[model samples]
Target: MLLDFGCGPGRVAGHAGRALGMRIIGVDASPDMLALAREEGTPGAEYHLVADGRVGGLADACADAAMCNHVLASLPDERTVLEVFTEIHRLLRPGAPFALLTTDPACAGIEYASLRVGEPGVSYGPGEAMPVRLRRTDGTWQSVRNHAWPVETFPPLLEGVGFTDVAQHHPTPDEAVGVADPEHVRSRDWSAERLRPPLVVTTAVKR
Candidate 1:
């Protein structure tokens, strides 16, 4: 089975299950996201809640691969990220692949200035604690707060956690198509010019 680590709304897992026929187990901290995923009726997918953003709930050596896409930045700390990686290491057999797709903060020039969301005075930024609410498939709402980390820090952290053959690939501008939001095309166009370099995709194996 493949683990859709930090699966949000099960979009990728659903696609993989239907198109690739992979048996998928999705784990996310958000119940709302999990409910939404389940409501999608994604065949061959199971959902699990990781309240602590760690994989202590999973059985050891139970998965062939794990995919974590755009989930790293939402985590709280390097230690937590490391713990999750180690847990993934424990759950996968030797040589199992861990494919991670995370944002390169440089790609967006993410500044940590205080910003408002939903409310007029609520503020959040990198290293700040904040709650995020997501709508579930069951029409319920769930909130979660995550710590953010930079892209450059991942390689050393992965290597420190007993993963080897680490490689980070930057998706070319052409490859970035279909990845951005349709409604945000104008925003992407402006940001594409501002941040011309590619974003990173890193993969490694448990050694």
Candidate 2:
């Protein structure tokens, strides 16, 4: 079985469950998100609600693989981040893979030339937390407080929680940047700096 931590509206879980043809357990803190997941998710997926970053209802070592997407950024502090990591570790079988995706600390303040979002920017400093504001499709903005940690801080934190062989991946320009039309491409016009991604993806093994 696979576990989707902070599954939100089951966007990933629903697609993954259908594609992989496996049982997927999706857990999130928001009841509204859980409700949406249950309403829209594939048959292979199940939704659960968690409290205080704890998945207390799940059995120990129940999952073969786990994913936490866009979650670390929303954590209020390092303690909560550690708790979530620890809980993920506890839920995975030995040597199971855990994938994490979050806001990239490296490209905190980059302004995209092609992609458009309401005031798309990151606010942070070296060794400091990042706070971000993102605009939804509805044109409303949501604030993500304490959304990112220094890039240097992640390795040690994963190691402390008994994770090994951590690897980070940055999306390429074609993957990160969206093109409205195939024929009317202006990717070449974007500055090299704008190609720097705003998100980071990492994978680690539970030890």
| Top TM-score model | 2
The parts of candidate 2 lying over 4 Å away from their true place are 113-131, 138-146, 173-194
lDDT of 1 by residue, 56-85 (tens): 467888888888886765666667788778
lDDT by residue for model 2 (1-207), tens: 889999998878877776677789999999999998888847867778888768767898999999998877667567887888899999999999999877666665555443221233644543354556665656576665555565566778888999999988775556533423444344345554346766667889999
Kindly state the number of residue pairs that clash in model 2. Answer: 0
> In candidate 1, residue 119 scores what lDDT?
24
RMSD of each: 6.4, 4.3
| Top candidate by lDDT | 2
RMSD of 2: 4.3
